[model samples]
Target: MALTRQVISTLQDNGTDIMGPDVMAYHYPDASIISGSLLTVEANHFAVLKSRGAVLGVYDTGQYPIQTPDKPLLGGFVTGFFGGNSPWQYEVLYVNRAKLLVRASGVATSAEMAEMVYQVDYYIHVDSKDDALKLTTHMPFSGHYIKADEVASYAAPVVEQAINQVVQVTPMEKINEHIHEVVELLKEHMSAFLSVFGITLNDAKVLILPKDDRMRELISLRAFGLSELDAVRYYTALKMAERGLVSAPNMAVGAPFSIGGATMGTYPVPDGHASVTLPKG
Candidate 1:
């Protein structure tokens, strides 16, 4: 889509800030202007074009010298033609364009402005259905009236599919590579510790003196019969501590651990207890 320099200058003169550098203006029919921000003169020309399905392309000198051409002129030269200004002022330009009917208007309310901006931004920013879904899921009430349940039902599957596709593809192997590096480092450190302490570094017996003392505490908790999943949770807690990720109170020594539902405390185990109860799935 193209915009004439005349149109750009007029918009600027009328206090309409040129939003993006690429907006170019051109002559379009009345129907097209109905969905666009229109100038009064352009609207009249558009009306004439719509009614007659044709209009004479006057020479830049304001002379109606040529017959209405059969084919639309996609590009052409025009000098300062006298409709409202100098005839030699013709400069052709292209604009980012889309058509949207005015939904509501009256000395613009915030809601109306938001709706207009949303329509334009959605058309420009959303490249695919998944992107649209992400936008809708994250901000469900942007422009139109949509029920919450309906929005969620419609959006969730698309977002889930996009996420699954991203995860399953495994395009970047950096995390896996990093995990391997950490394991190798742990192994080398363990071997050295074993040599110094005169202990065999068997896989099962490896002390796994985690990279830090917090990790050692988590490992100790896990070794004392915490479930593997719970061990991971404790490990995450330890990692957060090591990274200063949170500011929660420190866990007191020998205090009970409480998560979503499970609790671990320093209760005495009966002597001769031969079995442990596991959580029901």
Candidate 2:
């Protein structure tokens, strides 16, 4: 096909900060490329041409005037000419190169976690150009909704599996201490798991989603480094405040005694003994 019109095309991204707060998307219609076609791609953007679900070529920032003498038409209008150059049909997808934030979760399988749900906040980004293997393996596209599995299918599941493993071995009381360790482990594993998708795990965050009010209280207690006694004291204070009774000084004095006494015999002993013993005598 011979080029006929002044074809003007520019990389169009729905400003990542405002429009695509959560996703990477392109809003441009597919176009026919001629030798004189105007193309302007900016930094932090990857312009890609794909035919039949296969990526043909990847272009970087700057202007590109399509050279079509040797490039044959994939399939499109016949009459198209640009600076005496023929046209070729291809779909263009503008990929956002910036790192993205995503959230993923999985149901815990361990019997100990029967009442809690595990969640992970993760960061993912495209692999560096220097990695020859990732250049070929990583998924070409990311999904729009972190809530949806579309773009996060592989990455999310891999992260969820990693988190579940960590949570299984970790005591609920000390889970926060090992969160960084779990994130580091995920980084190493996802390098291989997500290689086929050409993405990398940049960062990860782990959290326990509580199942009930009690679980919530427990989590809050742990977060604030509060003993159960202290938590009860604070809770009682809140309730008392709600009822509009007792001044702060009086509540403070009454709180510790109430919580301490109420919790005295409630503490559990070791499985083997009700009290400390001096040993066989």
Candidate 3:
């Protein structure tokens, strides 16, 4: 087999913002790279060559001859340019290694089955050659450019899954108190899950709160020296008393209570026994 070097054409990504901040990847419309053509990859970008769902080669930030004389067969994709202008039909995808922002917001079920609303703003990027390949292979986009929205769309479910994984084991009352821990756990889970798609879950800021007023009230009660059971009991009793189901004046708990236009007072407790049990929230 005679290896011939032919400069049929030149292939290189040219643009002011070749790999912009929000861009994830760029698919060159031309799916053919002639042998011996110069392939220029910008900094913080990777040029991946794939043919028929197969990745032929991955070039980093550098200039290289696609099919050099040294290696006639470019990863076995090119046998020879016998016709002298033969082009290897391979998809050219430029993956940005620069950090990109992906924001995800969703509702997760907490340990007590409470709906927890979460909003996460995180940065991610294809860190390595393997990750770049993973990004191109796992998350394929049809258009010429892959934008942040596309990355966000792919990451939203993963973020939701991570939130559920962490929130499901965490009680609503402790969500805000242990928020830092929650953020760490979310980052850990998200990083692991998104890595499968070649996306690195970089630094993130996660804000989680109760989805409704009832859950908010419950969490607030827990913040004020009240246990989960106590918070629920107090919250439920307060609601019941507001609705006139429980007697306001006859209430016998130490906590202060006040309803609209009602006299504010602490429930009196009898000696040698706990106060009346309030219905669960």
Candidate 4:
């Protein structure tokens, strides 16, 4: 003879969009849901029912009655019940389908061997049922909710790796000048990398900066009447001379620098004797 069982008549999410921008997934408190229970899923959300790590079904923005005919998993009954509860056991996880902003920062080495700090602001979202399943399956969250910072934490290393790849081939002096190009490449690489986790990269903004203040000052010379080419040539010569790659006499005022077999014209240095006048700061 079959014993009596307790049934949860209704399962609903009252705190729908209230999850806000920080939350990614919300875990339903009850895992013992029986057939014929009404599951209310809010808009812009996915209600995923799972049994022992297996996804039984994904419901979007509607009320669903947990019936055995529709879901075969609901047919199996868990026996040896102490309390008058149904043998069926399942967990429902609500995934937020909204686009979320995630920010990540890291340090990368430039082609010039300069340590550059980088930050990326990106937008991501889980669009389909498959995306929601992958997210719930792969990214396990503790407690009741998974937050955006958790996603940011996972993205930080990936973003850094992508930034390193871009900057490692780009010289420090020209990094800022080609920042848009860098951002595009980062978006491309990061999009592919994040796709594995069921997240889509909508857009991203990347900012790269030299780790040293002196390097920043050197690159800023372009704002003070110096051309981009002249700024690179000037900073290159200074770095080379500092490293003893160029002789002291070759660094004198009006002395040209021969870099990569090409002659670069003189750069005026502030040593109490220079022809070009610079704006006083």
Candidate 5:
């Protein structure tokens, strides 16, 4: 009678990285193989097979029969000579083609202000599968994890350097006002830095807020969608109001009001009539 046997279940596959961000080095567990057992390796992935301590072959993107007859002459000879019915042990490992996400966000300091404290947020991912495998080989890992931060660490120093270079030379006046310009400058260096590890930055953003509450209020005055000159005019109006040079809201109609800096003089009164008008603040 014909009978069927199984190695690994088809249900074992899921998109989750077998080696997560915290776990780096791992190989698939050994499994028993029979003549017609299933061996399926998905597309855009690598399945490295090994016997004993030596790699037998790297397979990808195909279904295959794992039969004794399919084995090389030397391998078959060794198996036959080893004696009775010892289970054939094989190591099959996988590497992925999917991109991995990396994010870095923090306040970077500049020599200009002990630290010109500004915030930055960046999103990035590994650009190449080949490079990621090489990274896995080079990094230290005891079992299954390497830190997510360790994978993206190549970009952090670049970010700091970019911030330092751009912020140090920038005039203190424009540093907080034109942060987008600083981010653009940083991108030039970051692009090259990320390329080394086959990584790419995506939809990254930068924001600079005033550390002082007073300065923040000064900035919020532009909420009216005003042009720069209009903002200046609005600001001047606020200052005038604060100084009491502007009139009170309940002032009588047609009453004359003089601004604090204005030169006021009494006009010679006409004999027939007296006239008065409200003054603009």
Candidate 6:
């Protein structure tokens, strides 16, 4: 969502007050648009403002009336999106009448004008959060057309679902002990498996395996007996090998060993240990 604070700030900075329709014809007779007819007048103006890299404000000014030379003139800010590639501009023209008038202008075609009117109506009457989000991200213009209730209603369920999905198990000694046991079991299995293939384990706990070995066959075999935790660790080592983080006979010096499988696969073990896959039937 665009920050409300920035929207308000932008409005305050650029908002303007103009005389209503009655006064505009006399004051600026050359002006092409009239204020009171709801045909081509702007009733109010709003601007979206940004501050400190975040949207901070949306400022709105009071509506005013528009009248002819004989009638009293009313004044208010004009609200709408202006100066874009689109032929139609969205605006509300302030008039002497009590009711607000939303109008679209910029084209002589009736269909185009009708489309603009529809747009204005949609903006003023619709309560769509998705539309609001889209406008905030794409539109350069700004106003307070969005309602607070719409946003709250749309976001509440999503937030609740996220909170509900969070796992909250208590960390305990049993959990740690189980993890250690799985690590040790994996280590033993890997050592024995590597021995059959002439691979060896170093003091650092790295399993040195031949490049030509059937790594995938070995991995599939070991994966069968591994607890969830050990499987995670073994998968992680395999990933490291694929990324060239582990050493192998065929790889360039200091390059990681190459293996095959999902990148994020993990074995059920703590950090700082390695395992090698054994052949399967």
- Measured against the true structure, the TM-scores of the candidates, in listed sequence, are 0.21, 0.62, 0.61, 0.68, 0.49, 0.21
Query: Per-residue alpha-carbon lDDT of model 6 for 1-281, expressed as tens digits?
Result: 11111111112234643433211111112222232422222223332223223543332343323322311222221122322122222222121211122222111112111111001110121112232223344322213232223332332343222212221121221222243333344344433432332223221111212122343334453548865455545665565578876443222222233345323222334455764432222
Model 2 ranges off by over 4 Å:
1-21, 25-28, 51-56, 69-88, 106-111, 127-149, 219-237, 244-281
Scored by lDDT, model 1 comes in at: 0.29
- Candidate with top lDDT is 4
Off by over 4 Å in 5: 1-96, 110-129, 171-173, 176-181, 200-203, 210-281
Candidate 4 lands at a TM-score of 0.68
Best candidate according to TM-score: 4
lDDT of 5 by residue, 124-205 (tens): 5544545544444445443433445654465677776777676666644466656767788777777776656445656456
Residues 54-124, candidate 4: write the lDDT tens digits.
Answer: 77898888878776432333222423332444545678888888899888888899897889988888999
| TM-score of candidate 1 to 2 decimals | 0.21
Q: Give the whole-model CA lDDT for all candidates, comma-separated.
A: 0.29, 0.54, 0.72, 0.73, 0.52, 0.28
Local accuracy of candidate 3 as per-residue lDDT tens digits, 1-281: 33344322123336266556778898877644555667777777888887777777888888777752334454434344444333446567888888888887889888899888899899988888888898887886857788888877877876777667768888776766777876787788778878998888779998898899897887788788888787877786787688886553343254544455454543337784545543323
Off by over 4 Å in 6: 1-36, 39-162, 165-226, 243-281
lDDT of 1 by residue, 161-239 (tens): 3222322333222223243333344344444432331222233111112234554455566666887566666665566
Q: How far does residue 1 in candidate 3 sit from its true spot (Å)?
A: 27
Task: Return the lDDT, model 4, position 237.
Answer: 59
Residue 47 lDDT, candidate 5, scale 0-100: 52
Rank by lDDT (best first): 4, 3, 2, 5, 1, 6
Evaluation by TM-score, superior candidate among 1 and 3:
3
Q: What lDDT score is found at residue 84 in candidate 1? A: 27
Kindly state the number of residue pairs that clash in model 4.
2
